[model samples]
Target: MTFRARLVGAALAGTLAAGASALAGASAASAQAEPCVQRIAVVNNAAFVMSFSVQASNGLETANTDTYPINQSRTIDLTTTALPVSADVRPVVDAVAGATRTPSSFVSYCENGQTATYSVTGTTYDYSVTLIG
Candidate 1:
């Protein structure tokens, strides 16, 4: 090949290589930014039925169980690109009952595909959270 033609060919190859490298880098970043899927299972073992919402708002939308029954579990689906995400399990408490107890929430954090189980045991005033990776 002519010298000038060889130089032009080399330049074109370098440009293509650079473009491919940049595309690969962008793909890796997009994979890292993919939303992490998490599951939250809330079991109501208490005697009375209740309502609640499970959320953290750390880049994920809030999920709720509007009317949870006794001895049953409701799973909430959440997604976020952020790591070390937190779950705020807030149960609805009757304000007219006695002193209007604030909702006893169980706050916990989980990773990608991890499951957090919150059990409402004892009474409507208490709860517990267990994280499973």
Candidate 2:
């Protein structure tokens, strides 16, 4: 699992927060800060398999001495590990001025086997969750 990519969960939370703010305006702050509301959708671009040494061959063996690869996939369900990455509704509210709203959602794209986080600030919350393929 791309734990680094999981960081995107925070960014994802931020986007969701921004969207809530846009719809609720002043009330978005009161809303519970959460990342992956229920079943967050991630476009299954590809699946990447990471090999971990569940058990070492011997005491001298390292946990991740061996390496493996799995295809990367999009359209991931975050409900199972539904945990808030981060929370920051204040900054989002502060940024929102008149018609110009910061970012209400994340427009993520994968490049070079990594999901590129776009330009979005304040609203993005950072969280972590377990992913199973």
In angstroms, give how far residue 45 of model 2 lies from its true place. 5.2
Model 2: CA > 4 A from native: 1-26, 30-36, 44-73, 85-133
TM-scores, all models, native as reference: 0.43, 0.18
lDDT of 2 by residue, 5-118 (tens): 889988899999999878896564444332213222221111222222111112121122122222322222222222232222111111112121222333211121322221
Q: What is the alpha-carbon lDDT of model 2 when measured against the actual structure?
A: 0.28
Question: Model 1, 1-133: lDDT tens per residue?
Answer: 9999999999999999999999999885554322233666667666666655554434343533566567777766555323245444332332112221223343444456755555555544444333322
lDDT of 1: 0.51
Model 2, C-alpha of 41: deviation from truth (Å)? 2.7
TM-score of 2: 0.18
